[model samples]
Target: MFDSFVFMAPPLPDDLVTRYFRHCLEDSLFTLRRQVRMARMSGRFGANDETRLSLMPMILQSLLEDGIRDRLPLQRVDPEWSPETLVIAMHLYSVEARRIQSPEETRRIQQTFPDIKTPDFTSAEHTGQLREAYIAARLAALRDGTTPTSLSIGIEL
Candidate 1:
């Protein structure tokens, strides 16, 4: 039933969409940076850590912000992409950078860096699910003429 439910809601205004996406992107970047830092401090940082850390800000400022402002679909910005794809990409990159080999390692990392959250879903199927949930929540908020306090982008496994 949940999978079949669909709301025929109008698109949010460009300005509002841009602002919302910008906020989400900023928060994601901040969290990623914090995770990178924590990993470095814990001596679990990956070999390519410096490159990923350096490139993230550039991606945010150049690619993400521009795409958000233009109201471009993720595919238009980059093929086979979505907002959730970006989130998943960042999470996976962080995981790789931290050299997390298994669930056990992830748990240990979380234990050490309580603030860092490894997403439960990184598979393509989960990415689509997350994207759907995010859009649904955003559309509901727009329909009600209120900004959502938080977007539902990461459903727990």
Candidate 2:
């Protein structure tokens, strides 16, 4: 599910970052869950953790800038809102959302939302939309000053 496309030559760091961002943005909830689980199971973030860490902030910043250029409502309307902050918030939110959950908590969540069908991550098309909604809710909370940080992970965004 996380296959990289071939290119003419060695892809630039920026190219890799762009691809990663796009992959995250386009991933299904199930895919995200699987990815998060696999990462945790590996017991290390990645062999290239240092490289990824260095590139992620820049990638996120660029993605946010692109969003701004496209006139997407990525940031709160409040004048005090910072695009950089919003980018970080969005990145963290996405990461945590897909983080592995305890079996007990997963069962509890399943019980709590019995009516909502579990999303199929393999082929679902609206995961990006769902993720964007999560981001939007975080932005709304900030805009309203209802929450100090954006959101708590397990609340069913």
Candidate 3:
């Protein structure tokens, strides 16, 4: 006899949070890697909002840190590089890493650096416009290179 269906709770692992972060990071880094590499994408940046520019340095620092654990990021990036420059370089490095690691690499990398997904960047895209406005914010700093911007790495890279 058919009766009201009994609800079954979905399995939630003890490491669910870790697993979620891993999933998110893989998805995020994938798109960020592509967006950073798209040629002439620099033009997409507006001429103000130095606040967003801070992301450039942050991105560079992250990639450099990653390179510390793996030689790829270091080998591909120049220490004398700017944050904007680092974007492209990191994108290249990420792509290369993806290639070398096969499909299983993302999972493995998460195991090694469980916190990689913790980047504090807000969302960058919304309904149809730049969601976080990070690109616009970093624009001024990227162009002048000597502006009183907050995230400027004066020493280069």
Number of the top candidate by TM-score?
Answer: 1
Residue runs of model 1 more than 4 Å from their true location after superposition? 1-8, 48-157
Residues 1-157 of candidate 2: C-alpha lDDT, one tens digit per residue: 2333232223223443344334433333334445545665688765344343443343334333343223223443335536655455455535434431334534433333222344422221223333333334323323333122233234544
Give the runs in model 2 whose Cα sits over 4 Å from its true position.
1-115, 119-124, 146-157
- lDDT of model number 2: 0.37
lDDT of each: 0.40, 0.37, 0.39
Candidates 1 and 2 compared: the better one by lDDT is 1
lDDT of 3 by residue, 1-157 (tens): 2222221322223364344444544555444444443422566545332434444555434433443223344444568867876665556455543443454643343343343343421221110011112222222223344243344323544
Clash pairs for candidate 1: none
Q: TM-score: which is higher, 1 or 2?
A: 1
Query: Going through the candidates in order, what is the number of backbone clashes in each?
Result: 0, 0, 2
Q: What's the TM-score of every candidate structure?
A: 0.30, 0.25, 0.24
Q: Per-residue error at 28 for model 2, in Å?
A: 21
| Candidate 1, position 45, lDDT | 80
